[model samples]
Target: MIFSYFSRRRADRFAQLLDAPDKAEVESNASAYHHDAHDPELEKLLHLGRQLRQQMPVIGDQVRPDPDFRARLRQQLMDTAAARGIGVTATQEAEPDDAPQTTSVRRPGLRLGLAFAALAALLGLTGVSAASGDALPGEALYGVKRQTERAQLALAGSDVNRGQLHLEFARTRLAEAVAIADNPRLLPDVLDDMDEDSTAGVFLLTTAAVDRGEPSLLDAVDAFTSQQLPEVADLADTLEGEFRQRALTSLDLLNRIQDRSAELRRLLPCTSSDSAEVDDLGPLPQRCSALPATDEEESSSSENRDSGSQRGNDTPDTPDASPGQEVTPTPSDTSMPPSDGLPATPTPPSILPSPSTVPPSSDADSDDDSGFLEDLLRIIGDLLGR
Candidate 1:
């Protein structure tokens, strides 16, 4: 157990323990990570590892090649390539057009074997990594850089490891996207890959928690969700079209976490957990009642400011009469009052019928009226004759 880290996975686990953001995460994961129980050496080593990790950035800057060293190295590369009959042109290879073809008997297999051996030596001495600090965009080894990461992620032993690996891979994708910012064609695929990785990381973490898996895994995932996922989601918005859409799909995955979140909370309660005498640690938690409507100040919102009649919304407004029924007029539906344009026409004070309209009394009156008219006409004739 003292020398267990000779195995690659154990070494990786130790590294993860060191990578933990807080003392709680490290201590929580330590028991599962190292089975040594109480090896004083391991404890000391862990403490030393933490200190080294904190100082690594400063050391890294010190080790970087100075400008003078880089210039000399570049000049030496040109001199070497020239001596080897190599061309520096962007599109063409180094070998000259008149270079002789090897038709004679030669041990091509042996030559290939030597080439492979040298490549293996280089890879071992200087491991390929996507985060290879010097691997700028358009460099030949860039593809190999990501390939190394894929190999490592493929070997990840547990879901927790896979989840962390995927997150790292997602970060690598973001870095690559930034590196090739000008490449419209490749940018979308890169961003899509990043989103997928982030989503997968969150999914695995939540699933592990739901299954009552490792507490350390749950805690680690919780940390990432609270700290990292939001930033990645915001980064997604910077992209255009389908790339952004794929990223949105992953953001949707972040939402999926709530399905298992209760389980997560049960497994790993936060420091500020206020369970209120409710043991929510069961597989099925006690259903909490929905929160009351914002009654913080004992709200008077439902207290009416105006009377229901004043607001005119009290009873349903009287329905218009269907077909033949008499309609009752509410204030809203009443007719207008009559105007001064129409006047009363009764000029007679007596309430008597017309004389022609009378029956028996009126018949005698009509006969006398006819005789008087004939006498008046005769008088006019006599006056004329005289």
Candidate 2:
């Protein structure tokens, strides 16, 4: 029993040698081979027939299978002794061999154990290969999945700012995939998903910035438009129209104001008396005539017309009331130079006569006269009243 135990332990140690570098692989093989050497544990009842053949005394006889009558007779005598008590007693009584005989018994055992260890190592390698194929690249999976989720969120709603942020993330991932993806077929889905929002966001932001005079954003405009998002195009078109009109309007106002410094100064009450130059000397009627119709006012009028149309009504097509007819001060009033350069005595109200002239011809004529004079008088009064 002791010799059998030592032999089994030696077998296990030799098996471990096949997997010297890795503990996990060796442990797995040890667990699978947990039973005894030929364990399908044999029935405890000994097969005396087989035992007798294995222990038969055949020393110096080459121990080859018996082919002669003498050998068969010798083997039968040993079996008969084992079956009857004498051979059994002798086998049990044999002195234990501690060296040469024990070593000889282990030779075949060592070879068998080495064979099993090799088989276990091969199985271990095959399992490792199988496991590695399913192992995911964690960083790549995290980054790509995050990007895909963001793209889905952006496409679902109308949140412009959030959508833009997500679109940028998706775009970065798509660019990475483009550079490294082994398969071209994988590219189109990611690209198409990314384009769904990235194109629109870039278009809107670029056009808005361009209108604000940030020329840098213009770089993205063509690509944005090329993607052909209808909503993007519509937004760009609308903003472009408003910006174009604003620029033109500003230019128009600039021109109008440029040529009308005298009029502006005249309308402003805070002008100093001595600021007037030689060119500033003029009659009030003549100064009023020089106040040309400003393009800003024309734009304002057009805007009014547009608003009125939206109300589904024709705005009265009445022409702008003409500037009031300025009546020069009588020679009597003009001859006297007042303390200020202003005309002497109150000029009759612009819309009202001295109550001495002939009345206007008809209500139509009267309405016209009143509109013109009333407007001019009101403007003049507002200026002086400032």
Give the count of colliding residue pairs in each prediction.
Answer: 0, 0
Clashing pairs in 2: none
Cα TM-score of candidate 1: 0.33
Distance (Å) between predicted and true CA of 19, model 2? 5.5
Model 1 ranges off by over 4 Å = 1-124, 127-139, 178-182, 210-212, 258-263, 267-386
What lDDT tens digits, residue by residue, belong to model 1 across residues 1-386?
45564566556766787788999887878776556646576678778998887888787865555455578768877765665545454325444757543232233565444433333323332333323544644566655554444434433455557667766776677667666655546766776666566656554554344344334655655555555457547756676787677656655544433323433344232111122111111121111110122232122211211211222122211122123443322331222122211222211212122111111111233454333333323332332333
Q: How many backbone clashes does candidate 2 have?
A: 0
lDDT for position 158 in model 2: 29
Candidate 1 worst ten-residue window by lDDT: 271-280
Q: Compared with the true structure, what per-residue lDDT tens digits does model 2 show for residues 239-347?
A: 3344334323322322322222222222222111222111111111122111123324345444434432332122211122123432233332333223334323322
Candidate 1 yields a Cα-based lDDT of 0.45
